[model samples]
Every structure is written in C-alpha cells, then in structure tokens.
Target: MYLLGLGLVLSLLKYLEVGPVAAWSWWWVLSPFAITALWWAWADATGYTKRKAMEKMDQRKQDRINKHKEALGIQPRKPR
Candidate 1:
C-alpha cells in the first residue's frame, strides 16, 4: 500500500517535471508499483494476506464478546 502511494507520488512528480524526479527514467519512477505488485504476490502465495484477515476477524470477534460481557456487568478476560 505504501509502495503504491509512493509510486503514485513519484509518477506525479515525474509527470510534472519536479526536481530530480524530472530527470529520473520512467522505469525508476515506476519501480515502486512493481515492488508493490511483487509484495502482494508474495504475501498471497505465503498466505500472509489470509493470516492478517483471520487475525483481524479474531480481534473483532473478541472485541464484540468483550462488549457483551461489559454490558452484562462482567469483566472481560485479560488477553494473553
């Protein structure tokens, strides 16, 4: 995501002929996009993306349970 943003910024700067970026080759300006693509591909292949999604879901579930417990006047269990 960050790489994508960087790529976009670099592209804009290159397009507008800004400073040193103006002299940079399009390949260099666009490299971050390629890196971002590679990162995504690697993450997907390694299940990193799925793992993060699962962790997020688990956290949301725990937060929901904690909210219910608090509403019932029970303390939420401490996280390990």
Candidate 2:
C-alpha cells in the first residue's frame, strides 16, 4: 500500500513536471521493481523457492517410506 502511494506520487510528479523528475528519469523511479526482480532471482538460486520446498517434502516422504519398510521387515526399493 505504501508502494502504491509512492508510485502514485512519483507518477504525479513526473506528469506535472513540478520537480526535478525528468520524463526520462522516470526509469530511475522504477528501481524498486528492478530490486524486487533481483531479490527473486537470488532467492531462486539459493534454493529458497517453491521447488526446493517441495523437494524437502518429498525427501521427508521417502524417509517415512523407508522407515515403514524397515518396521515391516521389507527392504525399501533403491533409487534408480
């Protein structure tokens, strides 16, 4: 909500030419978006994204299956 207000203020400033904000300088005003994109890319590279979360869940499931097999005197299948 604060971002929306800031964007609206920046847009108004740019449209009215009431400040030092030049039309071309509006690109500078979009730095927040670029920063957010960079953060998302870094998160993905660091395994902090949804795929890593799902992989962790799958690993827990496999562990449970192996434990169950051991309790039943059955050997768990090896991964291909």
Candidate 3:
C-alpha cells in the first residue's frame, strides 16, 4: 500500500538523518504503518477484498464460457 511505502521511505530518511525529516518524531514517521495496518484490517473484515477477487474470477469464468460457445458456433439459450 501507498501508506506502507511512505512509512518505509520516511523510516529510511529518519534513520539516515536526512533533510527536515530528521527532526520528526519516530511516532510521526511510523504512523503510516499503523494506518496501513488498520486499513488492511478494515478491508478484510468487511469482505471487500474477497468480493473484488470473486468478481474478477466470475468475469474470467464467463469469458471462458463465452469463448467456448463462440468456438462451437452455439446460440445462447432463450430465457423462459
């Protein structure tokens, strides 16, 4: 996640004592890690990630079915 990357960059900068970040408190620098953790937890607990993955998988399955039907020159079934 962007937050984790930001935390990593900030941590490196703080460790190396580079720029104005050198004066920043470790708490401030590490806050993005906590934010990322919380975001991941919230997303997982809400099934958001699972829903997205399932949607993608369903799309792939539909595509495969359609491709097979096209190859066989089969007509789609009419609805009752």
Candidate 4:
C-alpha cells in the first residue's frame, strides 16, 4: 500500500516536473507499481492474505459469541 501511494505521488511529481523527482526517469518513477504487484503476488501465493482474512473472521465470530454469553450471565469458556 505504501508502495502504491509512493508510486502515485512520484508519478504526479514527475508529471508536473516538480522537485528532484522531476529529473528521475519514467522507469524509476513507475518502479513502485511493479514492487507493489510483486508483493501482492507473493502474499497471495503464500496464503498470507487468505489466512489473515480468516483469522479476522474468526475473531469477529468469537466476539459475538462472547457478547451473547455475557448477556446471558454465563461464564466464559476456557481456552484450549
């Protein structure tokens, strides 16, 4: 995400010929896009993205269950 943002900022700076970025070549200005793509590809290939999503979902589900139990005045379950 940072890479993506940097790419956008650099591209704009290069386009407007502003700052030191103005002297950089187009490839250098656009390299962050490639970097971001590679990062996402690696994350997906390793199941990191999917694992994170699933962990978040499980956490939400546990929170909801705990809230219901609290409302019913039941004891919290012991962790394994």
Give the top-scoring candidate (TM-score).
Answer: 1
C-alpha local distance difference test of each model: 0.98, 0.77, 0.93, 0.97
Higher-TM-score candidate of 1 and 4: 1
- Candidate 2 positional error at 66, Å: 0.5
For model 2 the local lDDT of residue 77 reads 99
Instruction: List residue ranges in candidate 4 displaced over 4 A.
Output: 78-80
Ranked by lDDT from best down, the candidates are: 1, 4, 3, 2
**lDDT accuracy of residue 28 in candidate 1:** 99
Ten contiguous residues with the weakest lDDT in model 1 = 71-80
lDDT of 2 at 25: 84
Candidate 4, residue 77: the lDDT equals: 96
Better of 1 and 4 by lDDT: 1
| Candidate 4 lDDT, 1-80, residue by residue in tens | 99999999999999999999999999999999999999999999999999999999998999999999999999779768
Residue 45 local lDDT, model 4: 100
Per residue, candidate 3 scores C-alpha lDDT tens digits across 9-80 of 999999999999999999999999999999999999999999999999997987788779888999655435
Q: Scored by Cα lDDT, where does model 2 land? A: 0.77
lDDT of 3: 0.93
Better of 1 and 3 by lDDT: 1
Which pairs of residues have clashing backbones in candidate 2?
Answer: none
Model 4 lowest lDDT segment of ten: 71-80
Residue-level error in angstroms, candidate 2, position 46? 11
Model 2 alpha-carbon drift over 4 Å, by segment:
1-37, 41-48
Report how far residue 31 has shifted in candidate 2, in Å: 14
Q: Which stretches of candidate 1 lie over 4 Å from their true place?
A: none
